[model samples]
Target: MSNSASGMAVCDECKHKFQDLKAKRSFRFIVFKINEKVQQVVVDKVGQPGESYDDFTACLPADECRYAVFDFDFVTDENCQKSKIFFISWAPDTSRVRSKMLYASSKDRFKRELEGIQVELQATDPSEMSMDIVKARAL
Candidate 1:
């Protein structure tokens, strides 16, 4: 599909495909907004199962920060095994608005890749349990 993050082509068919495949395989991805912005990201590869959030949060520049975190995992995986979590934050734009366009394009491309596997992605706001909640629900 078109990788233009400004409402990529996959957005049109992703929901339909997801609904069709939901019964066969439960593929879900969720987005969370951290309470504050992190100046830097600190993380380790392959965090321990069941303790990913702890490991992930520990990597932040501070315990409390505003950021967007994306989680991709299968619902059928009871233990959240093989789950992948992505944390992102905006950086100073030396390239002016060009970086924003690049990010949008990248996001659109990402959506297409996920649609290929029938994954449903949902973006939500930050809440009291932003970390714990995601840790509990994951994808």
Candidate 2:
């Protein structure tokens, strides 16, 4: 998406990669970061289909802000296998105020580029996006 009020444009590669994840299942998760110097959002890391949720979370810097989309697979109570696309905004408490504000302002526009996200999460810490919480939301 174009940088409007947020002053942060999402790079072309970021949108292309997100399409690969959504339509081709090329990735299990993707982590995005803002390049402050360029004032643009770019793909930071990607998780393969074999990677675990922990792997995805590990890509997030503990003291930074990031945007991520996770393709979560889970089994329903009826034993049906299901999957959900989760869009997560990760802004840890230790991150700088300017970074947090930038991420917050740019989140909606960034999320809109990755269509088909079924769930959304805003997390300041690991607990908020823990497996238990994600599983519950997937249900």
Candidate 3:
């Protein structure tokens, strides 16, 4: 997955071949439009377990304005990108947009990750938590 953000990112640390199931690569970019230019952000990390994935993009932007806050807890709308495993989003430049960083895995794993994210984000200091909503799209 190619993301525009250079900050902390969610990377494919392991790329071993899988035989049990065909693994299709998926990507999500945390993006924000500033000055009419869409800026891609980094996904800091995911929590252990609810809601969705707890991805921390650019904290600078989320803290900068109310509109740029990206959520690591829950998504209120339908998925923007439709991947084999999860949903995604994109920008006009064909750059993958940030919504939720989804790892196609067991349904149980997905549920665990989602729940973990929700709990972690909720535990964070309200001031430190982000309000940015990532609209993920597939490229």
Kindly list the per-residue Cα lDDT of model 2 for residues 1-139, writing each as its tens digit.
4658688998999989888988998999999999999999999999999999999998999999999999999999999999999999999999999999999999988888877899999999999999999999999
Ranking by TM-score: 2, 1, 3
Pitting candidate 2 against candidate 3, the one with the higher lDDT is: 2
Best by lDDT: 2
Instruction: Give lDDT: candidate 2, residue 74.
Output: 94
For 1-139, candidate 1 gives per-residue lDDT tens digits of 4433333233333344343333333323222221113311122122233444445444433322222333445454465455444434422233236434444344534433333332232322224335555445545
True lDDT of residue 70, candidate 3 = 24
Can you give the TM-score per candidate against the true fold?
A: 0.30, 0.97, 0.18
The local distance difference test score of each candidate is 0.36, 0.93, 0.25
> In candidate 2, residue 131 scores what lDDT?
99
lDDT rank order: 2, 1, 3
Alpha carbon lDDT of residue 94, candidate 2?
Answer: 100
lDDT for 139 (candidate 1): 52
